[model samples]
Target: MSLSVWVPIVGLLTLGALFALFSVGIAPIVGPKRFNRAKLEAYECGIEPSPQPVGGGRFPIKFYLTAMLFIIFDIEIIFLFPWAVHFDALGLFGFVEMVLFIGMVSIAYAYEWRRGGLDWD
Candidate 1:
């Protein structure tokens, strides 16, 4: 690349570094120094942290499986969106491929449904 191209990159890097330095240096002097039980305690998913159970509060296997299923379906949509955006360029072969992918996913979904993978309780 040319020197002109590098100028903006270097300028942005310097700007980021200056911002980080300023935030870190000024925060200690300007920001709140409060430390108390409520502020220090962990908060997650808008819920207060509960007392730990025995055996380190093991979550159910169903919870992990549901999370994985959500991620897998989410990724499938991510793949489909690009193909849909380029539908005309991809033509018939892409259409067939997408159909097959959906068929497989449908089968998986049906299997899971049959096995009660989608049940809440």
Candidate 2:
């Protein structure tokens, strides 16, 4: 490929890097300098943070299930965006493949739902 085609990509990358660096560099200078015990402590969604056990206690299985479900749905979105962007080019074969993929994901979701993976109680 010609080097000209890479110019826009390189420009965007440079712009992104500069923006990130600028934000990080400016934050400490312009942001709040006040510090207190509460500000230093770990935040737990606005609730008082609990002390960690000495043994680093195992997390409930529900946490893992929730994380796995998030990953599953995230992957579904990742696949879907590309397919949707190229829908016209992909045609019927792609449509069928996506249908099968969605069906499989749906089955997995149903299985988890039936297994109480979604229940908090």
Candidate 3:
């Protein structure tokens, strides 16, 4: 390729690096430095600062199951987008590939359903 193409590519990469560096650099300088006992306490995995509720309020498994389903479907949609955009050019081969992909997802969905993973109660 010509210097013209390489120059712009290099300039863009340099600009992107500078932008990211400046963003991170400015945050520490401008952001608050306040810290307390609550802030220092580990949130998720560490010991709970508060007492547990009555019945030890259990978290429903359905929440995680639904989130997993959303992630799987979201990924399926992402892959389908490019295939959809080039459907005309890809023709039968792309169509078959997409069908297979959908079939696999469907099988997974069926398995989840059969295993009671989709149940709410």
Query: lDDT of all predictions, in order shown?
Result: 0.81, 0.85, 0.80
What tens-digit string does per-residue lDDT give for candidate 3 at 1-121?
5688799889999999999999999999899999898899757433364567423776555656677788778989899999989999998999998999999989878876776777765
Can you tell me which runs of candidate 2 are displaced by over 4 Å? 1-11, 43-56, 87-92, 115-121
Candidate 1 C-alpha lDDT tens digits along 1-121: 5799899899999999999999999999999988999998886533457886534776655656677678769978988999989999999999999999898888877866776678875
lDDT of 2 by residue, 8-116 (tens): 9999999999999999999999999999998899875334567874236656567677777888799899999999999999999999999999999998788778767
Each candidate's clash count: 0, 0, 0
> Which predicted model would earn the best TM-score?
2
RMSD to native, candidate 3: 5.4
Worst 10-residue lDDT window for candidate 1 reads 45-54
Q: Judge candidate 2 at residue 58 and give its lDDT.
A: 57
Instruction: Provide TM-scores for the models.
Output: 0.61, 0.65, 0.60
State the local distance difference test value for candidate 3.
0.80
Q: Write down the lDDT that model 1 would get.
A: 0.81
Name the lDDT value of residue 13 in candidate 2: 100
